[model samples]
Target: MATDAVKKYLEDTNRPYSCADVTVNLRGAFTKSAIQKALDALSEAGKIKCKLYGKQKVYAAIQHDNADGPSENEDYDTPIKTTTIELEELNTQLKTKEASLKSLLAAPTSDSARVQAGEIKTNIEKLESRLATLRDSVEVMSADEKRGILESHAKLLSEYKKRKRICSEMIEAMLEGYPKSKKNFLEELCIETDEMVDFKLVSFQV
Candidate 1:
């Protein structure tokens, strides 16, 4: 949805985009890695200006005004918005997980199992509803707003990617010829989105 808003802004204002600029436009949070990915994507497709500014890189919408700093990637775009393309891709992720979540409905041979299946379905439905709401909100933000959110996200992602990369390289060197690297790698990956949140009700004794 932020993607759509970004596209619309670019089309209407004919403004060039940078990762920071896009972040502001999308108003959604993205990690530094995510920003880099988006910047690389837009750069490759000829949509934005991405340049290395000494210590850091600068990004902006393409063909509007060139930064005085040296340019690393010369890419700009037409009216085509890859955000739409991205949404389709994200949709595939949801679809792939849908079956896994829904697969619990197999006729339960036990009463407890039947309740478990119902509980899973209920949780799944709630998750879906929250996702739908967030998606719609993302879709509706203005390009400037989107850009701000993206900028914040990019800042986060940049740090995250740097740390992850370092951790991975260190692991690679430390664990050379050692087994279980795959598990470690996955644990690292799942640290953010894979953890299950648990809650409980308890009576406090006074």
Candidate 2:
């Protein structure tokens, strides 16, 4: 019964779906394992199509007449294009905001601007004191020790950037057919980007 239901769903939709997607769309009519088995049987019987994209397997109904139709991967690629454009727009906005912030900090004409400037000054004094304490507690290092530290920092930074990139791509893919904008989704999840925190990853000179 699940096999028939899944087969009919795929044929009617004529779109690719992952196992998790099928399970969610089915409204829990069948267990995920049962749905997966149905998908696999249909794929093996040539009633449906299955392809591995990255680590995930996606299935679609075989179309006989629509040979010139869009590829299944287009569903994933379309979101990526939209997300890229949105990111570019957001970057432009960020630059404008940064310039405005610099102007406010330099002038401090309004009450809010003056308060913010004062807070920033306090933060700077605290950071300077912390840095002095740290410097006093640390001993001078040899050239070899300094080089090793720099090499370790570089390796960690590379891994961090790689992981962040992978995560961003995955999120972009997941944004397909999502109801809300990427900014709203991230806000709901309380996720912060590097730009939000004014953080940047830079290579350490060894």
List the candidate 2 regions with Cα displacement exceeding 4 Å: 65-206
Number of the predicted model whose TM-score against the real structure is largest: 2
Who wins the lDDT comparison? 2
Clashes of each: 31, 0
Give the per-residue lDDT digits (tens) of candidate 2, residues 20-48.
Answer: 99999999999999999999999999988
Off by over 4 Å in 1: 1-21, 29-32, 63-206
Residue-level lDDT of model 1, residues 89-181, one tens digit each, is 999999988877777665455888889989999999999999889887846768787778777776776787688688768766866766676
Give model 1 RMSD, 1 decimal: 37.7
lDDT of 1 at 12: 56
N/CA/C clash count, model 2: 0
Q: For each candidate in turn, give its C-alpha RMSD to the true structure in angstroms.
A: 37.7, 35.6
